[model samples]
Target chain A: MSDYKLDYLDQLESESIHIMREVAGQFERPALLFSGGKDSIVLVHLALKAFRPGKFPFPLVHIDTGHNFKEALEYRDNLAEEIGERLIVRNVEDTIKLKHLAEPKGKFASRNALQTYTLLDTIEEFKFDACIGGARRDEEKARAKERIFSVRDEFGQWNPKLQRPELWSIYNGKIDKGENVRVFPISNWTELDIWNYIKRENIKLPSIYFAHKREVIEHEGQFVAMSKFVLIEPTDKISVRKVRYRTVGDMTCTAAVESNATKIDDIINEIIATKTSERGETRIDDQVSEAAMEDRKKNGYF
Target chain B: MDILRFITAGSVDDGKSTLIGRLLYDSKSIMIDHLEAIERQTKNRDDGEIDLALLTDGLRAEREQGITIDVAYKYFSTPKRKFIIADAPGHIQYTRNMVTGASNSELIIILVDARHGVIEQTRRHSIIASLLNIPHVVVAVNKMDLVEYSEEVYNNILKDYDSLAGQLGLKNVTYIPISALNGDNIVDASQLLPWYKGDTLLNYLENVSLADDINLTNARFPVQYVIRPQTEQLHDYRGYAGKVISGIYKVGDAVTILPSGESSRISMIELGGKKVKEAFAPQSVVIHLRHDVDVSRGDVIVKDEDIPLIEQQIEVLLCWMDNKPLIAGNKYLLQINSSRVRCVVKTIDYKLNVNTLEKDLSPDKAGLNDIIRATIKTAQPIAYDSYQKLRVNGGAILIDETSNVTVGACMIQ
Candidate 1:
């Protein structure tokens, strides 16, 4: 055995597990925000380790944008069934029609921002006082300043200027009837840490994360996958390339990077040598400015 | 590798943010896009120079106001180690933010403007660092370039800081003179101050030993959950899962479960899905016992020889952090480790004046952002050591049951 201790990862894991237990003990109604991504998958596995002798006290929730990849959706349902937990899904298309969220302009116009309306509606519909997300702070600049237990106002809006002081492991999850808290157990984790952890734990992820041949078209300097939700321009020409998604999001905006990292080890080595960030490669929304994530977070987008 | 978590505290215009920016920049931990964004924003400024402080000032309000409003964390790494830097606000009103940042930090870097020497904020940060029991402290005298790199100026600041450190009972104090704006003696050694000899900031950070920071003599294990794999192959397996708070525990060691007084021997210690011969402090592992006792969450396991005191009344220094004043007779949940019990504030002994280091005995109410010495009576007996003995078990948080908000952090006397 290596005498060197993995203290950093150990500390991160302990803190996350402690937060998970606190969620179970404190909240009257709590749910995990599962998206069939690597972060959420690690969260599910941690929840299982947190309450192994008994079933999970809280259910798993997924806000479906209605433009998700088929493999990702299938993976979500299968994982929920395997873990034997209740999976609650709220569709954005229903919210667009009933809640009058926004007009479905074109096939390519993003409902990504509209999913916030659906998510807040679901939180109110289920009376969930705490919603657990898998957002890591190292992913974005705005996320770097977030508290582990981030409080939201009655409208689910985050005021960055006014936030409670979180000291030690004590989390203040206090809110009124309409107000709620967003809990991020993996807030301190980095992108590289998540990848290394997944490799170590042998956690299964969707096939889209690995390199495969797919027909894609270039839009605004990003290789957008050609899907039913994508509106291909008349002059745009599609080409086949071996690519993999650095992050999973709405098919219209999420892009893929050219790679041949088919296995987990290869992906880890690729990430170590890659120059661009994960969000830079896949998230089209962040290309506008530096504070895009902060703006979205203030408007109650997870 | 061992993790070293540290915090930076100083007054405004002390180049606190600049030092952090230089550390990140020199370590090459920042991404190209982030650097490019900072570069683009720098060009927009009238100075036409890259403002290193802009890298840490993330909020729009902070950028517009040109002041830090809250604590912002920055992560970076070198080949030798990984660091989590907590950049705390320096304003007097944000004292609570400084305390929150220094609570979990192993080291504290107090920046002092060489021209201004020792000021009120310098004393405030030094006292807070000592009060929080930070193991190491680095007093970086910044802006030496403006002072012509004078040794007399550096010595004067050192003399004033020594008096403050003496009053606060701080033993480990290291001073280094540098100009954070010009990047002198921060990441690289300075040729200007060759008369003064010491390790550079980066070198000290990489070489500072933290093995002794943890409490390895006193064993503490707070049970977080019970792990049992109810499968055919592992049908009779039962493990108590928790993070080791302090000390080292080995298989076949004699242990005592708190509140129950049940004695047993550890059967096995498993970490990261593998069995281990021994487990030490700060490691999260699942411990199996030889006997299946009635142990659940909130139970603590300790070495038999070093049993904690079981009592219903305790004295503590409480840092109140709510908008409402603390009412003496009101009951709140006092959580220590994983165990929580109803506690009533018996009396507010005194409040510490942050600047004078004196106690105000006439203050009957502990208001918001006040640090007071108080005694509390618990509904049930809790097992605990002294704050200096076991940090995990000796500290607690006061929760308002009605609001479910953590209102105060308490350290046992």
Candidate 2:
């Protein structure tokens, strides 16, 4: 390899850093949406690389669904504290109560959709013009069609058909009042890419990403962790299994894969050898419909 | 493995989506669940066979209408390279989408049906591939099975395309015969076309030389942010954070900050918070100067010897992207890299006809998807280079002031 050539990981890191700085240079009140997931964790790491020596220009905002894994929540808090960045957490529970919104009632009822309400509310509350996300195009088809700097309307609705033509690295973050842009700095990174980068940088992740013994209910060959958020059925068969989360989401909706991988290398190897996609293997919310993600994005769910 | 970003352009009838699907499937990048989802969708349709086109048609409306509405990016990697495919819609109405996709792609695969050799769609796509100055072009003669894999049909289309490429000044054009539906000459060489001896589409993509495409001589680093750590321990630390879009920067190199024309010497370079002796093109690094200068975001840091143009008036090939028509004296915000200035479209010299490459000098206004040669005068002098020479510094976007939408794409000349 030539000395001038950048490794793929370095290329990805540089691209992401450029984008994060674009957000910093473009928006007035921008926020980095930290979900405590691996992708978002990687986003924070890139932010450190992009704006270090100086503090992050924006605050880290999390719209907590109230059904998240305790480990992830703690990790989110610790990561923010260690980096000395401001973290603002808004709860879906508060939004649900204040807005008199109905809770989703079902087995494994998820607050994933409800989190969008809190997210939009938080955006309005902070008047954030740009919300930096870690959404990768490889995650879903709808996301694949989305531009790096995605513009959303006053209602935070994403119009996939009418997306502005984003050309080259020149991002247009110009938006009218009440409108905002959702910038995905890591839009090009794949799930495996994220794991590989995490390994390369030795970035810290929550313990739930590794193997642990947890009581889980098996549904259609998928393991749903036994948490209070899940509605226990009389006929449900629950057992303790050594498993690791492929993706971290609301505990009610995120499924775990049976694994004994404890280290980052082990996780990378598993991802490389796995036949299913990251969302397919773990996200219970996406399997609801063919256009589940698209529908959610249209209605202002990032 | 390194990365290869490319775009696939063709009309719906040309099997562009199927080619992308075949590439992903053959590369084993398609997860089992994604395959199953598409398989289920295919089973619901009229064709009993799995429809690969369903994979690229991402939106519900696109799936329902059986057309790609926007550019959907797809990722796949072989042992040799990681690939990012910008699957853009190819209809004339969606020309803007193709331009958007082509802007970032290093290579473009223009699919032409064997039965209808070198049609208008093929010509239009070739014109775009030239206008965007994409480094590589692959003329994929798809559906060779329809013509019985005849060498005559393939050669005829190849000959016609070679001339079209010549007309557009498209270099590094590679032609291949294939059947995307049957997966011939895509991942592996096809036995049917025994007379053909070129590399398969995947093999060529994996081995194409992209290192030379990056210009390493003209240094252009547009500062995106200034990192000022005013903390007690590091009170004097100040760094210009940005990506080196082109060329190289070494410690102690004399640099010039533009628009302001301030001069300084690089004291230190930091890559990912670590001090580095030198940083090359496309690396995001924090550059610290030996002496303090009036440098901030939108300032271009360059080697003092090779400075770019700092001009207020410039000619550009403008692609109107918004639904609103573009007219003379239209004021918009023109942004090139980190530098943005209010600008007015002085005049539309001529419209470049996409289909025939004709220059319509009498065009009154440019509507959506129209490409025209226009002159723009910026409120402030912005540093740039000719798009043909330095794409990183030359390409810009015009934002509509009132709507705050990206209304036009400009390739500075």
Candidate 3:
């Protein structure tokens, strides 16, 4: 309009904020699914802008896998306190203890899938009509086909066939009584865009995202950060590696890439030069099968 | 970097996915790991040669069926500009998906198979592209290698598309001849067709003149949220937050709030918390008016001299997306630019045959994927411009009252 076109980040921000407002206006009871990940961090930041001077319209819901990093949990609590918004935490451990769900055993065991049960339970418990997420299309293959207002049925199952056609900037946030919608405001953003935005905004994140000297173990050709959940075995070699996570999920399944990118700028440059896809390179949880995400999504996994 | 959004549409075998695959491949957007995965998927497939389409057939069902069912967005970048390509499905019933992709696109790439020339699907896609007000259209004559890269075959398809473009009133049309499979004339110059002189698809996409696509002459800003920083230190801060749909807004500009007829002057414009000199279309900014007008979400702020049409009834070319037939007198929640109102289908002007471009005057019903000209009466006045005049403020979507699903897409006539 003014001869100066909006840069990619600015465009992405505008679109995402517009989406956030749409969700806020359309849904009566909406909650943001915050995992304290980079994506969720951005989503929360956007909510602040979407309703600045006014508190967030909805609470921040976190489906705790009980395998999250200590730093992530700390950051999540501090952020919620600082914003003075309600943070609802539903733990997978509760479901496991109640015998409704069982934790996987043996090698490469992850609680990522179990979180879906807790998530669905939380949604029903809170009667949330819409759950906002920071999922990006560039992250996964199935995500590329997901609508911005992804609808889930009574059991929170996502049907690929029944997806409503999202046209223009108009989103249909309508849902039945038991059914809820998953709104992905950043559906069009890429990993590069996220990093650039984080750098531009100077947003603080969990320390694990940056390079640090940490005790780690090599599993399946990946340098994984050693946490309490990670069981050390004879075959697994434990050593200190200067690395940072490309994505944050369960501690057992999330892998870290070798880098010295302690600053946001270095991470941005590292992502640009990296050849592997962001989620593809890490997150062994999605490697269960070719359609792992699709299968998991059908069962209400984000 | 600026980004260009485009949609690719044609028949199933027009190699739309392969074309996208080739563009990503030649642009060095595909990584080595993804290449290895594609190679693995190619081993069991009939096409032993690395099937590029596998990369875009994202859903498992789509890959199993070997057809794209929904729009799968792909991103790639060159030195000049970043690209967001929406690979729309080609099925006749998937017209809603095609329209969804084309709604926000600045350009549409319609692949016309060289052997088949301009077919029914080409016209169908072209009509939808034009209906959605896509500014640019590129008729890519694909599969040139199948037709032996004949100049006559390419010319014939171009000639057919030119006439169709004329009939469809496609203002900006570009013709290119290439083979998405052989990577000819995609990025690098192809030596096979020396007689054809034109810029390659990648080059043209990189250098296209999109400087004037957005509407800037008309000022339209729909307030999305009201920001009142009630902090003790910065108390009494009231800002109207929204993305500028069109035109420009500067401090001290004369503006009027619609629906209330309240007038005010811009006191300040803030971008990301910092006060910016000015804001333009598509940029999200928070504005503080000099006077506290009765402004809320869905209220539009516009220049006093250039106001949009505010009326209870609007004529629109509606594209139905639901399985339920759209019947006259049925009510829906019409949402446009943050404004939502109850609306009813007053009349079905005509159920136009999208493929044949024939108007059915005796229309009885409109079902899924049906694009028809109709009149919608809203509960209150809606501020809008003709879609041809300003798409950002002129388009709307219809939601079913019970299901809460988007049932129709409307472009005001």
Per-model TM-score, in order, reads: 0.92, 0.99, 0.96
In model 2, how well does chain A match by TM-score?
A: 0.99
lDDT score, candidate 1, position B273: 56
Between candidates 2 and 3, the one scoring higher on lDDT is 2
Cα lDDT tens digits for candidate 1, B225-340: 67666877778988888778888899999999988899999999977557899988777778889987878877889889888888899999888878889967768998887788
Whole-model lDDT for model 2 versus the true structure? 0.92
Q: lDDT tens string, model 3, B188-280?
A: 989998988999999999989887887777988898777765888668888888889889988999998986778999999987667887889
Which candidate order results from sorting by TM-score in descending order? 2, 3, 1
Name every residue pair that clashes in candidate 1: none
After superposition, candidate 3 runs with Cα above 4 Å error: A1-3, A82-84, B45-47, B64-67, B229-235
Task: Tell me the DockQ of each model, to 2 decimals.
Answer: 0.44, 0.88, 0.65
DockQ score of the complex predicted as candidate 1: 0.44
State the lDDT of candidate 1 residue by residue for A197-292, as single tens digits. Answer: 888778999999999999999776678899888877798878999999888888887898888989999998888777677888788878766678
**How do the residues A233-267 of candidate 3 rate in per-residue lDDT, one tens digit apiece?**
78789999898989998888989899899888889
- What clash pairs does model 2 have? none
Compute the TM-score of each model's chain A versus the native chain A and list the values: 0.95, 0.99, 0.97
